[model samples]
Target: MIGQVVLNSNIMSVNLGLGVVLVVQDGVAKVSGLIGVRSGELVKFKKCGVDGIVIGLLKDSVSVTILGSDREVQQGELVERLYEVVKVPVGYELLGRVVDGIGNQADNKELPIELMEKALVEVKAPGVITRQPVREPLATGILALDSIVPVGRGQRQLIIGDRQTGKTVVALDTIINQRTNQRPVICVYVAIGQKRSTVSQIAARLKQEGAAPYTIIVAATASESAALQYLAPYTATAIAE
Candidate 1:
């Protein structure tokens, strides 16, 4: 007999299977009545049709970071638990495809079910002793960088400089060079807080260079929320793993 109930402007109750939004502030909402939920679990706002993630479990309510426009969330809105943590599609099929910050396919095509697998977006890094050693070299196709500052597989290289300094070009070059490598190397390019046009140009360039077949672009554009931009790198890492 459980159903939706509205107590007041600040509180609303729904069926036992659902939760009520208590307060929303700065893209985080406080919701109550959800049972057996864990942090990082995904939830949906029924009315707004947007998703959120449980970030903190309070005494009687849970803190949710909205994945979409927080302005759409209202007090007393019903929330449904997805019963799963945030996950991204990972596999060879993702190569040459563009995905959003949360792993949604953005290339306007249906993802092939058989070629994809879901992976948790958040995972702890393995201990140093258990990690693989970086012994093989990864050429960036940049003569100066490869000759003076060689990069190894599984190594991290940072290209930092002022705007319009070709930082993106360097990264794109590295991705393009992977195509020439003897061993197959999958490159994941995560664009956080960049403009949509910029991401599009990068994708087009990669395609023109014949590197699109081996590279995946995960873009969280500047117009997206901070939460999404923050999650972009983790989502990319999960897909790569």
Candidate 2:
């Protein structure tokens, strides 16, 4: 079956099936008659002009989370399964730019060059045999941290504290310290549920400290839809990998 694809306001002719919106809820929507729908597939609501991703599959319906705005979607609207999953631009071109969860350029600056490489937002991890041990330390440049709680490469560490604590400051400092390190590392900072101003300040700080060129900021600010916030971390991790 043939389906119409609407991308960034442009309609492209492709062979895919279309589903009809059966229900709509807060950040969630249900579509019927999409037999080929797959998890993570991008779906566009024709009437509302919003994008969503398939999150669940029922016997007769597909559950989706609208990416940005979902208030305009209603029952009986046409939902086109783009057949392609959500992808993010991955190349040197994105190093210093701010992007949303789906890798759309958030900065107003025009891209200097076209991004030729795109990576799927969802990916599987490398097998155990392909991985190495974490013996090398990733210096944070903070004397207290380096001395007390040294982090190793490939190690996952969580920093938790009360509000107004220096959690963000520590992360920013670590990113900045990588500039002088002998080993090269690409950093991706995912900011979820943060205020827009707060994320902007963090991006500005990274640029000022010369870390922007080696870092990618994925932001899903507090004002954005819940779906974006939920996917921010996964998107950032995919970029880093």
lDDT of 1 by residue, 185-208 (tens): 999999998889989899999999
Best by lDDT: 1
TM-score of each: 0.90, 0.86
Clashes of 1: 0
- Using TM-score, give the best candidate's number: 1
Q: In candidate 2, how many Å is residue 224 off?
A: 1.1
Clashing residue pairs found in predicted model 1? none
Cα error, candidate 1, residue 56 (Å): 1.9
* Model 2 TM-score, all chains together: 0.86
lDDT of 2: 0.81
Tell me the tens digit of each residue's lDDT in model 2 across 1-241: 1122123112222234777776778989877767767888888998778899999998767898999777788876788877799877777777888888777777887754354577888788888888888989999999999999999989889999999899999999999999997754789899999988998999999999889889989999899999888888888887787
